[model samples]
Target chain A: MFLAFDVDSLKYDAAGLIPAVVQDVRTNAVVMVAYMNKEAVKRTLESGETWFWSRSRQQFWHKGETSGNVQKIKEIFYDCDRDTLLVRVEQKGAACHEGYFSCFHYRILPDGGVQVVGERKFDPAKVYGKNGI
Target chain B: MFLAFDVDSLKYDAAGLIPAVVQDVRTNAVVMVAYMNKEAVKRTLESGETWFWSRSRQQFWHKGETSGNVQKIKEIFYDCDRDTLLVRVEQKGAACHEGYFSCFHYRILPDGGVQVVGERKFDPAKVYGKNGI
Candidate 1:
């Protein structure tokens, strides 16, 4: 569906910020959602990797730029919120950079026990699937 | 359905980290995603707010403590990743904190024009719904 925004285009709240969603390109699984300013989004589109605006640090970040588990962009879409975006990508190794395929690998049960979701796609220790750059 | 992880619990690759998904509790809409190490998860649960471990900073952060638009914990879940987490929460005013509801507020049309999605739920400039606590 076509979205309607407050102003035309994504009008960041004087902070030059926006939201981004990470979706598994193949399975259509929503991996995670993070915020990004204009630069972060621009960097992601240019680098084909995931980058986000660190609200705390007040800067830009490229996911796995140091870890090497890069996310190659397949496609990107925006939700009804022109300020939010969905990024579909082909994750090379661990998107979490924690050695997990996705960021959502755990669950907090009603009883208080936290259950870990998903599996280990790679090893953050040795680092799996290095593209041999 | 209950998820089954490869290992017993969240087995982060020597990194002690996990994945987290942000979902809007009311509409069940996914906001955006970001990765967090163990400390981030721990802080969020304890604070009853969103705290993510910045892999770069390698420290725990409490959302809204600085921004003021805190996300009250409505519910949090984990995907099958065993290492990932899905956090469902009641966003106070604007979840994005960037002045929009969820972070998904844009769409890249087939023609290449980026269509802004969603609306400005609140004015980021004035900081609405401060609760005045």
Candidate 2:
């Protein structure tokens, strides 16, 4: 049921980071996409929770560490190139800092316009504080 | 029904590229992930086909250009950060050069092992010639 998987086998970018696409296992909705360093990957594998490398903060980010929107890992998959990762998880609360269930709430129309889809699940100000996330 | 969506609103990386996650509109299965520059994005929007910036070749890549596995865009969405894109498409043939419908056919087990999931749709040798893509 399992084949050998060496963390080193994964292809990371020049910054030693790989993008991880987080999806809701129940709904099959892509909630968010973020980058992860080797340490973050190891931590996520060992802890069964989502861990990412925040490019802006330049640090390790344990999902829902402060907002309680933790993502419990259900399954993990990698692409053929061994570069990108797909993480299926059971998400708690809103995945978007903007209060939507998923970060991809803005749909693009054919005419080069955007439309907001889905409903807001929580208030960002209350969740991530005054400045928000 | 639509809000203004200027291509300039997107936040590209320092390399002027943005990662795009391509999914099958019918199955909701993530098919592939690739980077696209502003020009590629504009081409995709205008042509209604998937186009990407190939980092290795340093050129524009039109999906299925040689293999005839073109993907017709059904819908496109952007994340809250505007740094990532979600593209829903009607894929014509195998998305993976390895002949899988999706590139993410390798699953990772809890014990840090990998497993091949899903069925291969075509023979890469025949599809992309002897060496394959």
Candidate 3:
């Protein structure tokens, strides 16, 4: 039975941040993880898109605001403790500026050398805005 | 001013997790995010590899562990807060199972329709462990 998933059940880390795992809704691949403060969480919920605070930039950033690449939230699920988030988004174009659908588009050889198994699809310096990645 | 950077100074997210931003390092693209508990951090630290906790899998998983692609950490830096991480890696293949170098490799069209600007480089169902993403 599908019951109401209680928000109280969600757990946040000591800094009021939660671990959010972004998966390729189509491919089911684990994207990256970022800490979302309560406001980031609220922004994500309110905008129906992914939003997080850039620890470095120290500001709120929408996933696609700078770049045309946007993650439209199709579904949002919380882990048992609510400390983690599983975001299902419909991505358009290359989700990465490295010219790949995912930034993970690489592999390590048995000898520890990096090998290229995919092709880059975009130029970050152009798409990521003047601010850059 | 050229001294070795201290790993101890690196800040990690709560849950003993660090906010790692996997960039193309080559293209300078931002990939997805995932929390790395202490062990995961250590694994990443000692190996010069990116290791993180799969909250869903509840275990340790290296980037491109199952996929032929892998991220060989070339450089890892910490944010001022000591809570975030900047991971520079040489991606060898598709960083995402969706067939992109990065998961954020998508951009929403002006009309709100998802568009495909990149090409798929691999078949994840075949690469990722039979367990899948």
Candidate 4:
């Protein structure tokens, strides 16, 4: 089995959640960041896809379940502290629900104003409806 | 002033902290990840260096203050949700407290084992004493 690492060894916060930094394997861009509990971590590992815990919705979230913007796991790493996780993935389609390739599309300009860095890959209105995720 | 973005607009967690993913501007490598509060964000913007809120110590931390591995800000971006920050920087030296170039030096193997991927730039014993951070 590929489940070699003990999930219990991870240091979870008081809420049993740990922040996962997701990176695009090809571009080395940080596509998104999310929280994951033990179950979500295991699911991601076994399923070979990204799964996260939705703090706001208080439920398990299988990434790209609705949008089809799945992230295939390339590698996973835990920091020296064992508190945080860094996940490298081959992202299929835009990682951002807003249709940008990355969630961090809004760059902060020198003068403190914000600017959009890249073109959107898809339209949020069409993908997640008008409200957007 | 470069502090144009209003800090209040960014969302903070219950502990008044937002996760910041630090990336290498030139290499596109994510060097480290840490937390920042409103004051820390303001300090980073004003000082052009990373300043973070230490959740464990419950105080402000100036990156590289003791290690001299400071990360100079090149660009900063916030996600659409405004709950996270992606800070691209010109890293001076090793970003990991353990002396690795990046905090994410461990790569998980297919069999679930982890292997250290990079060489240590400095000795943690020499830098942070025997115990290390």
**Leading candidate by DockQ:** 4
DockQ of each: 0.19, 0.60, 0.05, 0.73
Model 1: residues >4 Å from true position, as ranges?
A1-8, A56-58, A127-133, B1-106, B114-133
What's the lDDT for all of these models? Answer: 0.62, 0.90, 0.62, 0.90
Instruction: List interface RMSDs for the candidates, in order.
Output: 8.3, 3.9, 12.9, 1.6
Docking quality tier of model 1: incorrect
**Predicted structure 1: lDDT:** 0.62
For model 3, residues A54-102, the per-residue Cα lDDT tens digits are: 7667888788777777788775655323355666678766665555666
Task: Look at candidate 4 and tell me the lDDT of residue B77.
Answer: 94
TM-scores for the candidates: 0.50, 0.95, 0.51, 0.96
Native contact recovery (fnat) for each candidate is: 0.35, 0.75, 0.00, 0.76
- Top candidate on TM-score is 4
- As a whole number from 0 to 100, the lDDT of residue A129 in candidate 2 is 88
Query: Which candidate do you rate higher for TM-score, 3 or 4?
Result: 4
Per the 3 Å backbone cut-off, how many clashing residue pairs does candidate 4 have? 1
Per-residue C-alpha lDDT of model 4 across residues A1-133, encoded as one tens digit per residue: 3477778878899999999999999999899999999999999888889999999889999999888999999889888888889999999999999899999999888888989988889988888887666
Model 3 stretches with alpha carbons more than 4 Å out = A1-9, B1-133
- Summarize candidate 1's per-residue lDDT along B1-133 as a digit string, tens digits: 1222222355453467665667767765566555666556666766667887755456665666655667777767665435456677776666665566766655564345665667777675566355421
